[model samples]
Target chain A: MDVNEKYFKNISNRERAIFEGAITMGALFHQFIGTPINIKSAESLEKSIKTAMELQPCINKVEIEINRDILKKIENEYEYISLTGEMLDVKVESNFSDKSAVIRLKYISELKYPLMYVEDVD
Target chain B: MDVNEKYFKNISNRERAIFEGAITMGALFHQFIGTPINIKSAESLEKSIKTAMELQPCINKVEIEINRDILKKIENEYEYISLTGEMLDVKVESNFSDKSAVIRLKYISELKYPLMYVEDVD
Candidate 1:
């Protein structure tokens, strides 16, 4: 619960699902995380993303664009301090573009990281 | 690109490394995704996240919090129309909690979902 990536390395199998969530929306994730996945359904996209999210020790907020007209925020599940007992209706694409523009931001440094690390967030 | 969940299923090898990024922060992606991953380095966590994000056909803005005081927005790499041609300094924790709060919101329905599906926006 220290909030760092090492927690994942302790358990991840480095599979293809890495390309199926918010991580998929980032520039850093695309550069060097895992191999490319290849699923193409709304169900898989949402499920894979959900699978990745549940790993967090804490839940905060989940935001999504419903039809792109409404940006809905699901804060209760996190507020309740528990993962939803049901399935989510979100998903991701398992492909990448050579010319896709994305952003990679350094959000936090594990309060417990042994060494200090700073990213060149351009 | 027609976005959907099944897309990830077509290629996910049921790996870990998933608990290393934004997907690790979602409520739905938590309920059901690939198995768990295991890494323990800030480098791996950041790398895993970046690896997953670059698959989208388009890149958007990436937001990060520098020590939680400075919320930085990196939207250029995404705007320049390409993934950041370098490594990022973000990381994720590969763990979960039974008593943690999280949120899951349905965002899109892929301009091309075969059937009609609407989520309970509560």
Candidate 2:
């Protein structure tokens, strides 16, 4: 398995205290779960957000910004969800976008220091 | 559940790609798993290292440094394994020591950037 798969599997089991505590943190840590950003069209974007909310009810807010390149590439194929987190900001890139996508997630707890950014960089 | 427990549980599953990838990273990411540093006496320290080897056969090298305060506190009960990682150094403190214990682990892979320091800071 690749690093990405391993990372996801590590957090797959909620039985672990860390995973459970992350959930208990609620919207502060549980705010993410939006639709795949590579898709074009307002309907696809809406569907992604809707699907995200269905999986995670704690997500009260979601803000997505699609660039013109991504808006154009929706007609083709996307390779990966490129993600990068530096300092505190998250930047994402993919074959589907001319410009990178940025998402910011903030929390109230101190545990936030360890997991500051998560990008879908493919 | 506390954040500590949740974090551990999330990574408990080997099925996740990230967890398995960490394993595949081998000594680069698998250098840790030594005897708990809080243990006192050369015998206990030896035992901890021994137990660590048994759990992770891939560990080819391990260096340990015990200070005077930790050596002295071995006679009493301690509370936690305080650990801090900043920049590149790792500092560990516990009820067992007057001075903090420090350990550094390095690797060859790029993923090393993500997991900088992991102190037993219980």
Candidate 3:
């Protein structure tokens, strides 16, 4: 059974690229939002997330940046905090057939929301 | 700043519902796939996940079911295993104005992929 032919025939290649990228971006935000982390663990967590998310369909690359400045300012009793959208800046590149898209997830200060959008597509 | 007007106006209400639900489903899968868990921790994890995902835009509710049979069979050295997609059954319900959608994520035995799709929409 061809997964693409069965599951994605209705959408255009461009929409499929956008769809895959958007799904990945959403997955990245939700999956790790509550993980306990400190400055020492941030690098490893970022690497793990990058490696895992790249395994998704059509995803060619995943880049993650966790804000260390926030890690350095931890004042809680645990000396760490659960990861949140504000700490993440992510880019996921996906391709379906000849079409490709770059999806971005960034925390917008004014909206106080993590925005996911198609950054570039062709 | 009108978020719906600025970022999501291009997509129809139905597409927006599908998009939000898909994002949440992806987020749910990636975020929790690596957590250490045993039978005792599964319920708490499900509750936490449901609570957190409901906070996302357009998401009305999240339902998570973690397979406890697998949890009971754990034979690892640590008495727990990192959660995987095979052990999860999830549904994310999202709404965009009058349109609503239910997004589902479940592991497919034949494809060996955790599939996310629009299960229902209006």
| Candidate numbers sorted by lDDT from highest down | 3, 2, 1
| Candidate 1: residue A3 Cα off by (Å) | 27
Q: Per-prediction DockQ scores?
A: 0.06, 0.01, 0.40
Per-residue C-alpha lDDT of model 2 across residues A1-122, encoded as one tens digit per residue: 66535654553322232332234223322232222233334445544544553343223334433343534443323432211111112212112112222224332134423142333322
Top candidate when judged by DockQ against the true structure: 3
Worst 10 residues of 2 chain A by lDDT: A82-91
Per-model interface RMSD values are 13.3, 15.6, 2.7
Candidate maximizing lDDT: 3
Q: Indicate which candidate wins on TM-score.
A: 3
- Write model 3 residue lDDT over B1-122, tens digit each, in one string: 88778766556677667667777788778767889999999999999999998988889999899999889999878899999989999999999899898877888889887787666777
Question: What are the candidates' C-alpha RMSDs?
Answer: 20.9, 20.0, 4.1
lDDT string for model 1 (B12-90, tens) is 2222123222343332122222322222232343444444443322212222111211112333443222112121122
On the 0 to 100 scale, the lDDT of residue B122 in model 2 is 22
What is candidate 1's lDDT per residue for A18-45, written digit by digit as tens?
Answer: 3223343332222222322222233344
TM-score of chain B of each: 0.21, 0.25, 0.95
Interface DockQ of candidate 3 = 0.40
